[model samples]
Target: MSTLRTLFLSPRVTATGHALADAARRRGARVETLREWRVPEQQRRAEGSSLYAGPLFADAVARELGLGLLEAPQDWLARLPRELTLRDVEFGTIAEAWRLRRPAFVKPPNDKSFPARVYPDGSGLPGPDAVDGTEPVLVSDIVTFAVEFRLFLLNGEVRTASRYATRGALDVAPLERDPRRAEVLAFAERLAGTGLPSAVVVDVGLVDDAGWAVVEANAAWASGHYACDADAALDVVLHAARPEGEFGAADRRFLRPAPEVVRD
Candidate 1:
């Protein structure tokens, strides 16, 4: 049997990473850890069933390790309900964003290059001194939601889901059957039919007055599981960024490794 290899960034290994490592082991996968960003040149190339890394290192690892990190297409936004999506514009400079005539929410689409917040207008945003005005900034119309949920999807199937927040507060609730479940599922199903990535995280929220709407789409590899099932979430994670038909014998490094030796 071939080995199912999974690599993670050792430096940024969080509780979520640990949980995934454990779950992968249970599924007969071999898990490997590395400092993805600064991998020694000699060790740059590796073979594995799957790989997960921070956005900064993900591309590099995927290239060198021969893994595929699934992702939504660039124009996926066009496939969503235009009414639910906030009007967004990409600016190369805060000064360029400052030219907006109306209020909106602003953020970097994929990174923390700039703060994501509501601004009265372009001029109301932080100046160039706060962040790199030359970096790309996404300015979008402001929208609000009463309840927000995160769904882990795999090949059009909603494998696991959880209520992540309510009224902007950190509220972890299970996404069980309810009055809005059917409607929510319908929306997700619509998105699945789109050209969006087969495996990804879809954040949906209820605006009450506006009904259900899409909050955003996120790459499953870098998203948090929230209160979703770890085992089920792991299933999504495995396929979220894996090569085709690469399964093999289980690597037991994480299953039953040597005990850590601590010095007093």
Candidate 2:
């Protein structure tokens, strides 16, 4: 294979892309730095398009250069190929806001963690939490972020997994495997051919009490790299960029022998 040329699509002083690029380069790959690329202001005005012009540019470049695309997590990532944002909430009058359920939240849909209090609690505290209650902000039902899982993807395939800690940092090994991790992996398998971008990290969170719900999917744009096996992730990158061979859609059978329950 020709020397793999990678162009890092991010701003300067970024630790995420820098680390990955360094790893890829030391492994005999030629990497490029494309810090100039970012989502333009005008592209936001496009009508009814799910694709963001900025990341889409990287997606194209990755295709051309045979490089992989990694991105940070964000609202847009949850709505891939649709340019849909998890923002844009249904705001209501003061009366309606008062009528919100006990655990229901009154936060800007744009905010990731809800409550915005000194902590996510009833005591709306010192800062942004006290913003105008009547402003056209977002409100949503609050779900407990019990332990979270971050499944790294190279191209569209999943690499090894880890947990997303409270400080937004990646955690290596934690006690007790996620109860619903098995189901989450199954969900990822369903998207095996959905044309998701290469070099991406998928964050699948569980809904409170719901079995293995997709909290949100993210592009690798602003994602963190913790315990991500560079070699394994890179392999996914190389495989996705190559010409796809003709394969049967239903060729692989899952039901041949599924996993059995662990009887204690």
Candidate 3:
């Protein structure tokens, strides 16, 4: 039986959220769409509760309810072998990225703190006045993928997957229909021991002439389902966000840092 008794959703429920909510209902779990940052008084004491939302909002709710949300380490991608990433990637601060003399793909590792795109050069990045100089970001060589897939992983195995794009455009399709499905799964299995949270999203793509390479890793709580099976994706979400008391020893290392609450 699933331990999830109630699932909290963002106030503005997205198509993905709706799908997960529906799946939760089938599992006999209550769903609540929060209208604000505050947790409802009644749910404050609810047990077996979890959340699915964006990073900032999810962080706030997790802190309020003492839930442990798991995510990849901020430097996970940058630390991966170049053989896996298929490009040179570095973990550095926004200020450091500003010193780049050549075009590079830059993005925040765990949050949407800044736009993730290929900047012409250092001058094209956001100014220090706009973003903190010390904020962590990933800078990598530019690579184009001909096809991209999202895999929902749980317990070091891919529970579900979907082809989310082709040639940088939206093109959702079931992984079962793809001819290269086995290759994709094989690549994901190779990443199983890479220290990611048990439940997380891994995107892999076929670089134009580079074969398959990892695009990035995302928190299951914040990733889109695309064409994935909602039930399987929900399993990942439940594992990703659980009561702090339910976390195993290994899970502790992957917990996302609690966001500091701002008092009015």
What is the full ranking by TM-score, best candidate first? 3, 1, 2
- RMSD (Å) per prediction: 8.5, 14.0, 1.2
lDDT per residue as tens, model 1, 168-230: 998886677445667777767766566556567888888767677777667777778877888
Model 2 segments beyond 4 Å from truth?
Answer: 1-3, 34-140, 154-156, 166-184, 190-199, 235-264
Pairs that collide, model 1: 2-248, 2-249, 5-49
Candidate 3 structure quality by residue, lDDT tens digits, 43-144: 784788988999888877787776889899999998898889999999999899999999999999998877899999988888978987999999999999
TM-score per prediction, in order, is 0.76, 0.46, 0.97
The candidate with the higher lDDT, 2 or 3, is 3
Write model 2 residue lDDT over 161-220, tens digit each, in one string.
656653334445421255555765776675555444454556555444544434344544
Per-residue lDDT of 91 in model 1:
38
Point to the candidate with the largest lDDT: 3
Give the Å shift of residue 123 in candidate 2: 19
- Residue pairs with clashing backbones, model 3: none
